[model samples]
Target: MGIPQVSETVERLWNGWELRMVMLLSLYLQIFLILFGRRRKYTAGFWIGKLVWLAYLSADWVATFSLGILAQKIGDSNRGSIPAFWAPVLLVHLGGPDTITAYSMEDNELWLRHQLVLVSQVVVAFYAFTRSWWGKDPLLFVAIPIFVAGIIKYGERNWVLRSASSEQYRNSVYSEMNELDSKFDKFSNSEFFEMTDERLVREVDLNGIITEATFLHEADLFFQMYRVLYADLVLGDSIHLATHIILRKKSAMQAFELIEVEMGFMYDVLYTKLAKVRKSRVIFRASIFLCFVSALLAFSLGISKNNHAYSTAEITISYLLLYGAIVIEIYSVVLLLFSDWAMLWLTGKRKPLFDSVYRTICSSGFLSFLQHDKRWESTMAQHNLISFQRSKAKLTSISLKKLLGKSNIQSSKVVGADLKKFIFQHLLDKRTRYNLRMRSHDPGSNDLHEILSERGDEVFGREESLENFVWSVKFPDFNESLLAWHIATDICYHDDVRINGGNAKIIHQNTETSIELSNYMVYLLVDYPFLLPRGIGKERYSQTCSAVDDHAELLDRIISVQPFSWYESAITFDIEKSTRKVSALWAGVKLAKSLQALGTQDGWGNERKWKIISEVWVEMLTYAASHCGWKEHAQTLTRGGELLSHVCLLMAHLGLSEQCLTTSRLD
Candidate 1:
């Protein structure tokens, strides 16, 4: 009746419960690494490699647990041992196959080492099965599911390596639109501009005055105005839509397509003048491949067997793979939702580029007539024509509080004092203000307005005809300088402050907007002097904003050749249409500035500092462009330069010493 003594090895493992303790420890480690290790910030690939190997080592404990479970049920020691060894065998098969366990692209290099560990585990599992005094059992059927899942995971990892590593995918699509066959070459007549003409209105940024000016030139004012309003409306929609797409649940393919579309639009915008698009396709393919592999792995796991035990290893592995699939799918879904429909919508809002040919319009500009309050009211009325005419208009107006949410500040006040102050402080110079007031400020000007209204009545006659004429009327004498000033204030005060304050936290949000247009144009024209504008028709303009990114450089070069210098006097005159040309020129200049800074500074300091400085400038410029009425001036230059100084100091502390010492002039 004496109990059979356990073997010496089993006895040793039982000393303070070493075997169970090791298994438990292994289980904890695996769970911890899988859940949290991947998210550890700034961890090198080496640690990630170690974690992957840890999962392999831990799988042995899972095998031992399986064996123990089998042993308890079978009663016979020989039958029990077979199931025990099977766990390790399955673990060996499943262990070395993941692209994201380390969450770094470089982690793929460890796959070779994974092969080595995998081989060793296979050997151990084989020995455990054969050398041990264990009998076979039907429960060993569990290994079948595990083996299939392992194969799937391995294949997924391989797919990720192939797709993500491809160089062709990194280029964007917006850069290719300019290459479309130049079918409308007839519109190229207005493309050439004599840059040296002093009479031509120029969009200039002189110190603080930059923020005050919106119209680069009076002749170009309508184009800028059109660009702003169109971009505002369309980009707003895109932002709303992109946010929806990213946050919503969707299939991997759907999400991939959406994100791809966004990238394509960016390419078009950046590369309108170029013949070829660059690397976006490659990156897109890589992204799609990753999601595809993830989907396959999830499919394999979903069909796998369910386990009853809470602590069972099968349940754990199944859950891991299932959740991983969800993450991948969801990530892709979010990406797709954020496509560049917003950018396209905004860019084309000014006017359909195709229709522009018939309309004889190539670009948009500020409307000087809009400076008159009555004229702006007319424009607003025109904008609301459909809404105002709708049967639900009165009801909607009454419920505006509900639809738009409660107004924080009274609408009138928000646009009154703050707006007037902004306009006077930034937009009006003493000379222009004096002249404008003297010519237009008479109280009796309203009588002149009455007289003009009466005179117009004599000409057009009927009330219906007058209303129709009013609706179809275009603004006269567009003021590019004043509008640019408003835009500058808008960017600096409204958008920048809100964004930095975390009220408007959006990723890839900065890339789509009228503000983005202003910053991009300014950077192109002012920063890159040697480049010239190549005449791209309206269709090309639309395409450029929507094309792939690889053509960005080509677009930059083509636009740079146009004369790009900012002169204050240019805004006062009936200058030739050239804001698009200048904007393109500045974009190159801005990019070149970053390059120059990056080139001279050696070590990481140069690259890092220059990049930070460039980003700071961009942020400032974008902010200024969004909120203020400034049309043509690059107003963010002064504030951005000031911020750059502070950023340089900060970078020095973070190992950017040389950049802080470098004394480059903003002027």
Candidate 2:
């Protein structure tokens, strides 16, 4: 028998090999999209972000290209070809990944463009199906339902993008408030005011002990408060209540977890179909499930009926496409089940069945892996320009290590678990004290700065005169103060080690936190200067660098003479005079000396002295964070977010932000 071959027309119009390659490429892109879309939320390293960025851009392009190829093949071929059978699968791919609908906030604004693409692609897909199937191709039964499901999925994505856009979010919030107001006016003014105030007061029990359950309930109740963040609305009594009911009561770890869940909800509201899915969750899930099942059944029936008509390669590709769609749908279902949305649902339920399921899931190890709260597991990254300048050789070595894909060289410098707990506890204590003071006085009686200063004095057991010396008069310029305090902390930290001598190990824990935070703040100063208070000139930074460089020779000599000696050992070479003549380092050295002297004079233990310094730095950090513009904090969400931004949001919620003062004025 003569060798069987494809006809000349078929070979010229559409090659089987080319169609297969495109189909395989589309599948590979889908796999990449699904795997890496959510990785950014957990891993904020450079390489991971780059890979996710690449995958994000390519997923849509590859899917669109495959759809184009399928359309072309169907139009060109004399008879219906296998590639035509795959057009609906392309539609499914075009729906995009569930993990990310909009890559950034701006992407949400392009929903109309996505909608246009949706319409055009659906037309092209339908045209391809008509050209190939006419009335004969049984796979059309499968294609029709899958096509519908794909359109629905794509529409859901567009809807989410639109809803998440800033304008839309603000409008939604305004509409909700207006509706509430309209309902209120239906009652007498006195009655309405009494009922509303009662509702607000009854929502949270201020005197009651706060547990995880209570915190969760408060989070749900304060949805309106959080929603205002997106709309840039001024918070009122709701935020003050939140502080008393939630923020002040929880331990640091619990507070952080609450914030994590809150951020997770924000992420969902801004980036995914979560808001839409949440409205008709059960119905939506059932509808999608039915579509998948119907598509599978239709595909199975079509294949069984026409098994002999299609080539083995074509049949295998068909099966792969069907199964791939099924797998993606299943994965999305799992994500929905494990998300904070599920937790929210569980929190709202009164049913025994849901409560038991929630308890079981919360206790399971699997929940840890599924939880999408952490942006990065490490506390925060550290990058100090001054430290880098001090050690060029070490910088070169770190660069090499990074190039070789080694872990962070400063990973050891990450805040230890014990230190984190201490910082949290100290901050919580300060907040509690501040809250008490506020309650004891009249509302709006003291400004934020006055309150902070009073709290600082109380915490350090210092009178106003001593507080003025350490913080007020000596550190008038924010940047200069930061530089001086940072250097002072470094000096004291090294000096404390030498002073402890035989007991260095015992005192190391106390000094380590001070050193870490000092460096972290300086790192922020250099890398993210915009976050700090303004009005400090660049000359101040230059002067400090000059002072450090001027003392380099003495520093080297001190290091050589006493390899393990304290940094203060170099001060004997008129270092104090040079620092004073050159820049603010003089103030730093004096401050360090004063702190040490006070600790000795007051018989404050090594732990007690370091605790005071740590608390002071934490206060400074929180002040700076709270002072930064909300728009600046919002901008960080696209770059994998930051702890500072989270802190700012927390501060705003607790009615501690200066931004809140301005916002309140607007009201």
lDDT of 2 by residue, 490-523 (tens): 6666566555563446565657776777677666
Task: Please give each candidate's TM-score.
Answer: 0.26, 0.79
Output the number of the TM-score-best candidate. Answer: 2
Q: Give the true-structure RMSD of model 1.
A: 26.4
In the range 72-121, model 1's lDDT, one tens digit per residue, is 43324422222332334234223322212323434433555555645554
Off by over 4 Å in 1: 1-11, 14-30, 37-99, 109-134, 166-667
Q: Give the TM-score of candidate 2.
A: 0.79
